[model samples]
Target chain A: EAGVAQSPRYKIIEKRQSVAFWCNPISGHATLYWYQQILGQGPKLLIQFQNNGVVDDSQLPKDRFSAERLKGVDSTLKIQPAKLEDSAVYLCASGAGAHQETQYFGPGTRLLVL
Target chain B: SQQGEEDPQALSIQEGENATMNCSYKTSINNLQWYRQNSGRGLVHLILIRSNEREKHSGRLRVTLDTSKKSSSLLITASRAADTASYFCATGARGAGNMLTFGGGTRLMVKP
Candidate 1:
């Protein structure tokens, strides 16, 4: 009955540095997601994974941002050459299904890029 | 980009008063959900209303959805200081595999 868990509640990095965040979803949840929430804005979906396969990542910045859900349970999101604008909160959520299910979110990783 | 927009970006009211927040979307959706986010914390799901359903209630929360107008509203009865937080409305578009597009969110401050 544990909720989604994330690591490194906060991070600070310089521009062009690489940063990675980790997420472990709730047990038995098949759908996992990563979202970016900028200050004063709603969360923007960065990528989604159903099991070990990616369901969607249209908004992901392919040039520098990448994520993987290996083994289909825990996932990681990485951003290389981070930009100052990338300073925002990274949230991870897990759902029981891909449709009509409630998504449980983690505390999120707050990344501050200098 | 955000698909939904919330009205009155910020609202302040005394505790024990009703708090109402409205959201409008631009596309077809399967369901609409509301979430509350405390300061520096992740979002917590409040309620979900399907496109076919008009209204739903949980505890002191009431949600109304109007598909024809593509709008929804959330009402918190007898609000408390604990209710102070950012409220967001998210839409699950048809055929989008339940990916949600969230609105900018409404910052509500319930004073005690």
Candidate 2:
């Protein structure tokens, strides 16, 4: 089986510019998540989706960040008017929606905002 | 806020030695998982230990969880240069939307 897949492994953008990242999760996985990992820090959950429905997005910056999992297979995360603080690795993961199931992660999209 | 915190932000050891990393959490959790990332790539799941379980072993990796103390330890036996990577501990709680809260990772460098 194929693992989760992401596009544009690395991205460089200027502050105030917009950027978007895409993620295609593993087949049959119902839970998809987006996380941000700043340098020297652990990944912080930005949003989570379960079969096209958002499970949680309390940490997402509503003013600047938004994500959607339309059709529930692939998802996209976008940041408009990006800021320097938004420079971080964006990771996407998927799981089987079980309490004990392990999540599979994709090669993250590293964004560098200047 | 991050739920878990790993100790010893960085560790360096020679090959063939055992490497131990510790993680402590603030709230109750259903399970704790350990992952390894190589050169900023995607993270690979190493091990997972449930709250009801005390210890688990997978090949050279051993994980011990102490719910009473809300701490966990990971031991890599006879470490190799290939084991050099950043290790992170993630906690899954019952009320935390089933999302894993990761701790700041510990960077381990195994010298040959």
Worst 10 residues of 1 chain B by lDDT: B91-100
What DockQ values do the models have?
Answer: 0.73, 0.69
lDDT of 1 by residue, B9-68 (tens): 999999999999999999998899999999999999999999999999999999999999
Highest-lDDT candidate: 1
lDDT of 2 at B46: 93
* lDDT for each residue of candidate 1 in A26-68, tens digit (9 for 90 to 100): 9988889999999999999999998899999999999999999
Q: Stretches of candidate 2 above 4 Å error?
A: A97-100, B95-97
DockQ-based class of model 2: medium
Model 2 residue A33 CA deviation in Å: 0.4
Q: Largest DockQ belongs to which candidate?
A: 1
Predicted candidate 2 versus true structure: per-residue lDDT over A65-103, tens digit per residue: 999999999999999989999999999999855552588
lDDT, residue B110, model 1: 99
**Residue A79 lDDT in candidate 2:** 99
TM-score of 1: 0.98
**Measured by C-alpha RMSD in angstroms, how accurate is candidate 2?**
1.2
The fnat of each candidate, in order, is: 0.71, 0.75
